[model samples]
Target: MDQSISSLHMRKLCPNLEREDALDTVLEVPLPEEMFPNRKGGSSSSSTDQDNHYAWLKSQAFNKATDTPPPMLSGRTAELQLLLSVIGSPLIPMPVPFDTAFSNRSVCESSIQASTAKYILQQYIAATGGQAALTSVQSMYVVGKVRMSSSEFHMGNDNSSAAAAVPPSITRNGKSEIGGFVLWQKNPELWFFELIMAGCKMSAGCNGKLAWRQSCSEKSHASRGPPRPLRRSLQGLDPRSTANLFVDAVCIGEKIINDEECFILKLEVSPNVLKSRSASSFDIIRHTVWGYFSQRTGLLMQLEDSHLLRMKSGCSRISASTQISCKSINNDSSIFWETFMESIIDDYRYIDGINIAHNGRTVVTLFRYGEGSINHKRRLEECWTIEEADFNLHGLAMDSFLPPSDLKVDCD
Candidate 1:
């Protein structure tokens, strides 16, 4: 073959190959088989096939260099944002005095379990810092570092040989990414949370009237559900909020965790709250929360909750301009995704007389399956440590917690 013609052919085979390299790098090989002995045969078929494969490999490498990040890596940006909002943010303590309710709950009228739970919570209040100390704080600021990772697993048995041979993309051991977050909060539903990970910033804040989330390269979006307290508040970050959340909860039982006896107080979301959170496309089946208060120290050692969501697809019709036919989706048998999270609180250290969990670990399991689809499980984990915390910040203001200007406040 003519040398110039061969170069042109090579360039055509791989679009990404540079023009100069394609023309100048071609060598007149004395023995092609010696160079690539893996070729099945020295026939025209093998030679052409081998060349095509090489071209493909080169194209893939070129594309990878220029392509956007892998979905898993880019997806972490959003995940970290959610992590900060759910576990990193500090929630403002309700202004209501803790003693008012305690004094009203007659010991004789309440059930044994309920009364016991209340008494335990009072001890928690004292351990966290007395009611006077807790109520004295009007605002909080916190900074922390975290390492987080997420991976999926298969839950059900699949006997197919193909399935058995193709292992999951995520392995038994995976790498985690390091990130940092800062949070600010004031009394009565004002807070801000920001997390930076992998060069992306995830942020969410509430200005008492509007709650929104904003991340890199995306406009802000309002959160679903009625105004709810941030979950991170209960993660030993704010003991007063934790006490209030379980004030009416019944002590379901006791279990030994990490070789320590703990009382389990269970709380389930009210039906009305669930209805307000659910939308046309999404139905919240249930949300239940549990707290594991260490019986030894009267402090919370762990927190857990699980929620199920039923997502219905194909319910809405396309715009008339689209000119397409659609079928109604049955909400009864819609796909379901459930999330369960358990956090182990440890390394409790006193910060300004308040017992704060400085270091903690959380394990999250996400189960996603349709009525007849293969079940897939994803396990996400996060290890967090509080780097700094302060109460009654010198200059924190409500204006600092204002929602982003670009937030989509119209979304239902």
Candidate 2:
């Protein structure tokens, strides 16, 4: 064979061999018997056949071992692209107000006038009933509902998980039966709440005699429990009780400023009372300020309350201001407020009179603090209304509302 062609053939036969390495490695002798130890050959024809077979085998082995290509990563690359697209997409917006009237207040007296606490309380009182009528009622039955929303925000700390996990905002609708009993010289009152929501029900009833709770639900059978100490301390449904618990805390006083009627109240909650009420679970110290307003008419114009509650883990502060101006006294109005509460705030509204007083909005902001530079905050806005209200003069039985003896299982 020509020298160049022979070299090319040798290259093909030994693909891994290079010019420098080939000269020292290629053998000039005939095929060795050890290279084909398994071959059975002795005649001349078999010898020729073995040589050709060895050449072909060498070519096949060289191509298999030396010509293998690098792996293709197309599938892995595509998967990575898909993951990026999903992670980069826009997230669902939180349930916050896009526009609010209070957001644009300027630094002026009018701004202060609208947001003060005293204005908010008066509106709330008038919405329920006039001061005289509210005071006149010996007992009251308030049926309402409450809804809560929760969201997780990044703690932005090393100790936290790479992704923050937050419980889904659960909207719970339930019926709450509240009874206010007269206490303390017909001024203060005792209050009870029987709430059924999301298949979980808790009922609390208290008077000067006793305070108790009963939980009834599908997951847990009806059971009696102990009453919260604060509930026990509450005086009966009278102005004196109301004055002590509410009015005393938030100093209730009337004022007529520039013909625009306003009620100023300062609230100071006792830490000792909160600790006693919380028992062993949580320690809370709460203080509040209220502002109520009326435009000469008995109707409440607006009500606002600013509250601050401190605990061991952190603090929760809220400013709940409600404006109850437009008064439509009719069955439909009451129904509208009740329906609103069911849909947005609470699950139940007890029928009161033709007037509905529970239509209001609440904005709450929660914060969690940590040792490092870790802080989490959340804001929730809700619109609520009360539908039905009645008077519960027949006091609830104490034994009927106590926790069941079987519920001693450790809930913690």
Candidate 3:
């Protein structure tokens, strides 16, 4: 008998004796391109054989390995492995270069900063569409579902075990409508909120002087009421006017981090601003990081936001981080022309040209305090597209409609 066959038979009979012949056979096989087909080409034999061999080898190695224990990983080691795996993965795309062909060393430092900020702002503006287009947008109707989760706090003697209990969860669906206008001698403005959340099922209008909200709940009769005075609510924040404000605010001094020059902007939330009804109930603290804009399109290529505060309790906090990029923008649309005309057709005098329409997706990662202790984090991963947007220059004025006599009024 051959020496290899005799050894194999002896190993099988003894069972306790470790098999060396099988190991030798695998080690002697050539692992070159000739033995394995090129992976780039579509081939079945190489991959199938490789998988089968690996599985067989792994099983055999573990079979008689009673004395050898599996490797144990510490928390830090596991984290490092995860980080390495993420960094090594091909799913993440490389960032676009920040330096532009128009970049010049001779440019003044201040001029460079201003030019860079302006270029970035323009890119963001153009990414949504040109400033002209954005300015013309008057009213936007958005119909989408919103998922909300709620948790009930539990009080117990056992602190550690109490924290381990699962929190109660609830979800709700809703939609929103937003309207924009020119205010304070034609300064651009914007206002929006969830219609259902406010407990009002009616339309609201503002014309700098007068403001109004009508309610049409099932319990209440259809009625048109006087506009609620939200001038104070309307005073400070205007998404359209603040577009440039955001650009300027984020155009802070530059610093080098990890050998890359980055512009860091600290966004602070004022208590006064928070107290205002216009502010959302949720906490939002935004710190934006900016890179140079593309010279050709004059749009921002990359933007990163750190420490996006969503909720805070005691010293514990929940936050999210985000990165946004504009892939493309289309300016020519016949549907836009039709929609713009139809919106202004009734009050032909008041409607203006379409100003801004944008569609994009954002990836958000939520984190909890105590190093992932609290489980209040979620991705809520969603993509939003702006389907219809129209801005009316002349405001529409509706005649007063009376409330129904048999309305069920809740005076609680």
| Top of the candidates by TM-score | 1
Q: Report how far off residue 139 is in candidate 3 (Å).
A: 5.1
lDDT of 2 at 277: 37
**lDDT string, candidate 3, 1-412, tens digits:** 0012111110001112366433211011111122111234321211111112111112112111123312222222222121111111101111111222123333354455555565555554554454666555443333222111112332323355334332221112112212111111122222222222111122333333233222222222211122222221111111233234334333556554334444443333334432321112123343332333334433332333333333212111111221212111111100000000000000011123322323222333333332222223322222233322234323322221223344322211
In candidate 1, position 89 carries an lDDT of 42
- Scanning candidate 3 in windows of ten residues, the lowest lDDT window is 336-345
Tell me how far the alpha carbon of residue 403 in candidate 2 is from the true structure, in angstroms, after superposition.
5.1
User: In model 1, which residue pairs have backbone atoms overlapping below 3 Å?
Assistant: none
lDDT of 2 at 172: 21
Per-residue C-alpha lDDT of model 2 across residues 1-412, encoded as one tens digit per residue: 0011112110001123455333222222222222121112211111111112111111111111112312221221111111111111111111111112123334354434334443453454454444555545544443333332323343334453212222222112211211111111111224444432222223444443334333321112211122222221111112112222332223356766436575655444455543443322222334343433344543333333333222221111111232222232111111100000111111212233313345444444444432222344433333333433445333333432344454332221
**lDDT, candidates in the order shown:** 0.59, 0.28, 0.26
Query: Candidate 1: where is the Cα deviation over 4 Å?
Result: 1-104, 155-174, 315-329
Off by over 4 Å in 2: 1-136, 145-148, 151-162, 165-190, 207-244, 249-263, 274-282, 289-291, 295-356, 380-382, 392-412
Tell me how far the alpha carbon of residue 237 in candidate 2 is from the true structure, in angstroms, after superposition: 11
The estimated TM-scores of all candidates read 0.72, 0.40, 0.34
